[model samples]
Target chain A: MALVRVISSDGAAFLVSQRLAKRSGKLKTEIETFRKSSDNSEAQPEIRIVTIRAEILRLVLQWLQQHQNDPVLPANQNEQDGRGDAEMGQSQWDRDFLAPMDLGIVMELILAANHLEVKGLLDITCKLVESKITGRTVDEIRTAFKLKSDFKGNEEEQTRLENRWCVEN
Target chain B: MDLNGTSKEVEEEVSQHYVSPPVTPEIAPTPPPPHLSGETCWDNLPPEVQEMVVEKLGDKPKLLRYRLVSSSWKKTVDMILERQFLSVWTEWEPFEQYPYKMNMHDYYDYICGYDELEDDDRNPTTGVILARAIIAGVPRLRPIWSHFAEHDRKANLIPSFDHHLPAVHNPKLGSPIPSNCLRIRFNDKIWPEIKRFERSRRAKTLADFVVKYDHCFSYLRALLLTDIEISPSNLATILGKLTNLRALTLEDTLLHVEPETQEENAVLPLHSNLSHLRIISTNSSASQLILKAYHEQVISLETNCWVPLFSKPYGNLKRLKLITNLKPDAQFRQGEENPFPALKYLSIIIHEGHVFEWDELSRTIDACPRTLINLYLDIEPRWETEEDKIRQLAMSQVTIPNVKTLGIFLPTIPQHAECLRRLILPKFPSVQQINLISGSWGCRSAIHGKSENETEVYDREEVIRRLNAAKIVAKNVERMVLELQFYATVCPKLEYIVII
Candidate 1:
């Protein structure tokens, strides 16, 4: 099979099959653009994703390879379903793929998947982040996200009080 | 090798295995990524990603916490909640006013331990609670009870109201629930205020709610109001204030003035931008008469009263739901002009014993033959023999050319089945979705003297067989929503069966 070169932000280059490279919409577009500009020759296309680091890029590529044969969902899949990604069911394998990653890596992977236009990966990663935030208190979420609470005395108390109705049992 | 490292180490192993195809060997478990510092957290993610994260949270309580996460997070979540009202009971309160004063006797009978049932043993579903509350002369409870009853019918059992009700009140309700059942922390003061109705600061009126959540009204797309206390002019004023409101639901609410009475009527140019209006009032059709200015803009309308539809032409109406009895008005002027030129979704729900209008319904359907996309007939015919004659005559005059969905919520007895095959299916040859819902009175077997459990199974099989035998010849049925008790196995291209 024909090969393609994928270069990550941190200067890591991996030789991937053309089929695998086509899984990433960004990579696929890049390859298509290259082929169009280069007269559709047999020469391999090199794709450099500047925003995604080597490790994150590698994880994204792994996900793409695993789901290489899966049917492509429409761009307006969420619109068609009339629901957001949180409600979409992911496969057991996809769940397992994301289960081990720490929150930091998961967030990074979400960014990478987003940059690569991998809807499935982006959806699952977002769902994971949502799972972490759901049922958690504001303080707990703040801790998880390492967010510095910006509200002071009265403002903070008011925000808390306003939101207290939602969590009240 | 360090026990804890960045994800880079983990990827190195994965890449090596991918590059060089390895023999079937158990892979070494990589060490977990080191604890992430405050370098990259949720806030640092792109705003679109943040929105996606929030969308995935789904539950209002979690979204509420996220709204206070940070300024940026608050902005994103606020936008979402504005467009979609996230408050569980904000638009749909269970009672107009609390059932405290009116039925102290029933309330006492249930909550004051008249039956001597332990609070833990009294695990009534929201349906039962709402039913009891409605029976106790609470007018506001009817709408809420209807909502829960529909849910109960869909679930085929009383769905636990555990999520909406205050869980800590084990004194009168079923099972002692954990305080965090609704995911909100109950303030020590508010709990007593909600139950006791004593000296405390709590939302007692819709006006109070409007003041508290004033920010939501500006961008609110939909609002369902059933509180009778709010007058028509007050509602009109409130509707006028909601700048971006698109859908409005008025249930059993009254409006005093008529729109035709231009001189005295204050609500003349109502929410003209409203695309959807739902009126579930059985007693008062005044609210429907008040919103005549919106006829040109309303794309969807659901009402029990037929006056709103028959009174004048609604040229832009794309959907119409007749929940109440649609009696043919004697004054409805017959004309060659077609109103509802863009009408697509038509749902006529005739309850038991209500007379079904054959000629008027057929005329309505004939008007939108090419435009109608979905036809739902939720009718419990007064008499099967009479319905057959009416169906044949009515259906002969109409044909929905572009209809893709056909939902029939009627008894699937042989006679009705024959009528469906003869009258309904052929008229909608383009239908790809068929939702065979059982009538509100449960399956046909209930009337045919079958065991309760066996009824559902028999009905499901009967429906499939009858539908298949009807032989409409429409290929690739995609969706079939049946009663909650039954699962569909007949459709060829069935993606999923909605159990409701």
Candidate 2:
């Protein structure tokens, strides 16, 4: 099994199985291009290092490792199914793993997942974040996340109005 | 040594004097009381980190609070807030009651930017493309022109003398124009081309046009016109003409009685190509009328408050969902008459009061048991009488042995969890996953501390115990999801329980 070196944004390096890394379309494409270049001897040695930040890359690799062999879903299948049986089955695990993490960390993971093109992880993380805000009031949400209120005067009122509309009929 | 000590002391005193009394504030000016107002925290974070923070907040209202931190932060927060709003609107289903309101200009902008619309640039307006496919028509530029002219007219709220200019040159003009001359002129300009195509004698041309723009019907897949009162004849005509429709969703559209003709008994033509059908209505008569012509070609059938006469079963249906007000007596009597046999996935939304009679329906389900692999039941409890509720609770125990996945909602009661444990565990042997959503204080109190009312509270250990007990009782269960909604603190176990 060929191992691929992944360098995170924070300069941390971890070796991941090439097969597992290929689960991410972005990494797969980069690897393919590197392999093509190496075949032509157009680049330096073939030690390909996929550089993504340590924090974000770690989550992506963990997810890919967990779901490496899962079947690629059909394009026309309902988008909801992208969450998949595996993730839905372990939704509580995913939820618990996310609960204690800083919102910033979760957001970083989401972006990283998006960048890596990890559909399952992206969907689950997005859903996790979406769940927190779906039925919550702006004030209550601010309190929970320790966010400072930025809106003032009319803009604030408009936001409240929009939120009320969202929550109510 | 004694003489040197005096000299050393003098040297020490001189060094202390040179040290300036440890830099003591000369006037001891009370350091301007640490200014607390202009403190910066999140602002000091790198822009990327700040963005990450904002994104983590996602659609939560907390992002709004970030604006109060500083002016620069406010701008970034506002931009993100707007993006989040638009993202939610685009991704999630539009609110049923107040569908996102857009004016003509906004609608035009949305259409222009719509990715699908870009794919068919030949048809400037998606609406005209759809209209062309609906009623065989010529695509004219006049509709777009008229729309803009009308918008300009409306914005100005003034009469335009040049509105009639489009009427003369445009090929889409209609005859017998209305008294609103400008509007009529514009309308006339647009209708002639459409009318010409409609009046075309060439069947091949019509068929070719239908195929060319058939994919335009995908736009109609988003329509939620439930309140529209549609005549059955009109519906039949419209639906019959929509040969390319893949999905048809009708929610509470009032059905008008069709006038009987000599061919009243004639069999209605079915749309064999329709792949998905979703019909939700409170009116049973309307439901029957809609189902009467249901083509067996559908792969997915979703109906709420409706039951079909299963005269011709669709063997290809993979998903069948029926949400109805259940009557125990009716269900029990209907045993042995399993309506949907080919359904691999089934979801039932049953009233809590009717749960007691679910066992009666199990006989019917048992007849075609093996095919159903997924079952979701939303049991809504009736909070009328305790004794009656207990009887219904007991009824929830009747299980479908073959169901692989089961979701149940229990009423909030002191013994609700225990009741569900007894009712559900034994009956569903093949069940791999169970989702149990509990209602307020009665169930939630078990995990979180008791409310001031001293209601039955559920502790985390208690919830875990109940789950373990339920799992033990269930023969083949692999995972359980316990969700408790409380008046006070939510159940801690819910946070840890893995949902399968």
Candidate 3:
């Protein structure tokens, strides 16, 4: 397998297998285009630097490395997977993986995963965020995320009035 | 001298009066615009990019926050959020009991009311108020209308929320309505127009209202109708308008009309894009109407009624799940003659009232046995007797020639293990997978008497022996799923065994 050097936005470089690296669709496309455009056969190409910031890219790479050998989940599998036995209980690995991250970092990672088309990472991050939000009060969410109370006086009052119907008894 | 002084003073006073301007109160200096801080406003992002972000957010709670970001973002969020929530809610919520009562008025009020409002306004105080109003208002409206509105009309409104609402409330106008005011303003703008056409007048009954609101039912892909009573004409009329529907569920609802009337009113044509159909019916005739429709339109059928077994078999079905009290008969037809050539999964529940005659079931299996992948048989123990022994023997003899997965549910402990022993050791030769689910009463003795270790050992050995024999008979057996209630006494030692 040919080795590909991936440089994150912070200028840190990591060598990964081309096959594994191709899991990130953006990188695959970039390399493919680069290969197609190059004319010199002996050209020692500079390492490809993906522009995603270093921290986000690191998390993405870590996830890709861990799930390198797992089955390639279909694009629509997130919707179709439902609540299978494998997903019913929290896996300890997933718990530890997500434990250290804050919501903002998790959100950024979700965006990164989506941009990279990393389905497993996107799913886990989305589910992690979903788990946090599911039963929480709006106030709790605001406090957790440090959201400002942007509603002007009665505007906030009216929203609660409207949301009242769907709130769980 | 005094006169001259007076004249000078007069001149000075006149000059002062001429130069004086109207006195105005000093205004407090306006505060400088509050610093625009934190993340960039979601609206400032390009529209296409915002859409991409919303798409990435999919239908999750992230979208909820996106809506609260700003008036423009709220519009985008509301557009997507309403449709997604309604679609999933319409399909799943009706059949299953919710932890809290879901009143349509309250739901509607909440969606309509909160959707426009700013996030801050929806506080505990207003939440209580709105909740009370929804709880009080929804119960008064008949249940049928609520169910009908949920499925047929809500989906069509998705596009309106997504496309129309944003256009009308262009955030670029600068003076954006706060989230709290948006919903009220939007409703003020639209609902009165809808109501003015005497739309509310036509909505005296649930069916009548849904029909009248047909203009709004176009975008729906999935619909759930539970405990709603509809006449054949009304049902057809309502169904006909929902052309974009993909999944349809009719649960515990009564369809009271003649078969001929139903045939005339059958709105779902053979080419309708419906893929999945689940009908849990208590009425036999109604079940038949639904099955007839299934035969005509659906690719997958799940029924909790036994009428299909007696009715002419359907041809287009790709999956069939039956839960009923009907007995199997020897002459029961199978396949396209009983047509299920495309069938992949078959699950049947067998109880005292619904036992399939042994020979009938065998013959049914023998016919249309091709393309069948998964089969589940559930037996109620109360009816298991000596008479059932002959039936069990017939079942053992029947060839499942191509079955890949098999599940058997037993209601209680067997009085005699002879039939099971005979059946397990060398029956159903082509089986690759097996699941045995035993009832609570059946495994009680084994659970109560033995130490946990002894229990585990005995169960494991028994399962291994049975499976080993099965492996010998059915050379392709590779996986088995065993679910026992209270009995840790028998475990299966298959290579891929899952104990539940």
Candidate 4:
């Protein structure tokens, strides 16, 4: 099998099978561009993804390798119904894959998956972040995400007034 | 923690991947993951990713909590709220216990004072206000209109408020109006409106209310209007304003007059944007409107009345369900217009009718011979003598070439097994599913209002034998659903038989 070298931001190089590397749309398009630009058909292409760190890139590759056989997620998933990850083809493996990651790692993975155009990884990671915020109260969420409440009394009142129908509880 | 330093350093390094710096730096300020466990906080995610997380929190209450989390989080929630804003008017009706309470039209008797308005009277105003208050703190305008407050109820005393005239108003949480998809339980001829006037505007007509809330109606998507009392013209006017509406449900709506009474058919304006139109009106006006105005665009229609449009050419109509009394007044015109060329799903329930005519139903199915996919026929066939005629009709006349799913609820007799095998089973060449719903036993006995000892044959074996006999004719039928009310013995006759 032909191999593709994927380089992370920290200069860590990982050689992955071309089939698994093609799971990332960005890499696939870049490989296609490289194939066209260079006449040498035998040389293995090396692509650098600078936005993703070495650790996060490793996780992304793990996900890509696992889901390489799965169908590609539709690009306009967000524009569809607001129902959660199930509609986006999230699976048990995906839930288990995200369960062990830290919140920071999950967030970083979301940015990395988005940059690499790995939709399944992006959807599952975003769902993980959403599951954190879904049922928790404002204080619980603030504590969970380590957020500082910035709105003052009057501005808070203004915000409350705008969302009158949904804030009954 | 040193973890924050590492995450921040990595975040800054990641930012270098972008060709240029973002215009607003604070919006992209890479906050160190602030959780005390030395983990990275979700504070530094981009606004787009933040929006995705909020959108994933589908329920309203959780989105509300996220809004209350912080100003930036609130902004993310607000962006979602803007697009998915739902406005609902629940036309509150008193339970069976309070039937004599003030109705939408006759509210004058109940309103003896300002507080004398019945529960239904306060539903639209308080409901919308409370619903909005659930979202916003205090909406600027309180547009409350009680249809029965002026005419049906008598206001003998002034209203009372907890806050005195001189107090700095510390209002509770709620908005009087929601800007998005409002699932309002609408009743009465009153249109939806909320105003800032000192006294309530009880006399304002629905026209005035619509004019006031025209902008709100413009953005409306899904509207569920229940127990609406309006003239056909008013309904047309209301539907006209909802230009972007996708789904409209009118339940138990009473038209001012029957459509047949009009000197000429009402030249109603078409709502081309409407895709799903469901009307539960006893009168045929709603169905008439679908036929006349929205024949070109409506995809799904569920109405109590069947119109002449079924006999006419309708290429776009996919799903049609009729739950009306099969009175002889149904106008099934034998027109040259090709009917239901694209119809895929059809469900017809004839109430309290014994005689099942072939021409009325056969023509429609015959029209869409190649297109009809799912057919559900719920009709009470006159028990004994009509069975022969039905069998002959099914055998000779009915031929739905492309029907995939077929459900027939008929009064069956043990002797009519041959009738089912010969007439019914062989008609559909493409039927992959067949459901035979037996009303009561093998035949109607004294238990089912027929004379006693009509044939105590409630045998599943007999039906299975007949179905096996019929299976020879339909080789393509993959599954068969048998819904028998009573049966003597259960048998696993066929691999595909699902007995219910």
Q: Work out the TM-score per prediction.
A: 0.61, 0.39, 0.53, 0.58
Residue B311 displacement in candidate 1 (angstroms)? 5.6
Q: Give the distance in Å from residue B478's predicted Cα in candidate 1 to where it truly belongs.
A: 27
Query: What DockQ class does candidate 2 belong to?
Result: incorrect
> What tens digits encode model 4's per-residue C-alpha lDDT throughout B162-276?
1101123222312212333443333333434422121222212443444455654565566655544556656666667777776676666655544544624446666667767
Q: Which is the leading candidate under TM-score? A: 1
Residue B111 lDDT (model 4): 11
Q: Write the per-residue lDDT of candidate 1 for residues B471-500, one digit (tens) a residue.
A: 331232212213221222222222221112
Minimal lDDT window, size 10, model 1 chain B: B177-186
In model 2, state the lDDT of residue B24.
Answer: 24
- DockQ (C-alpha based) per candidate is 0.24, 0.03, 0.06, 0.25
lDDT of 4 by residue, A1-169 (tens): 5667777665667777666677688888888888898889988998877666566787888776566556665676555655544445677787788788778788788888778888878888877777787677777878777677886666565555444433443
Error of 2 at A160 (Å): 30
Chain A TM-score of each candidate structure, as shown? 0.85, 0.73, 0.80, 0.84
Once fitted onto the true fold, the runs of candidate 3 whose alpha carbons sit more than 4 angstroms away are A5-108, A115-165, B1-204, B215-222, B258-271, B282-285, B306-316, B329-338, B353-361, B380-398, B409-418, B424-427, B430-432, B440-500
lDDT of 2 by residue, B72-184 (tens): 54555544533433332133221111123322121111111111222354354533321110000111212112122222222210122122112221111111111000000
Question: Evaluated with DockQ, which candidate comes out highest?
Answer: 4
Instruction: Give residue B300's error in model 2 in angstroms.
Output: 3.1
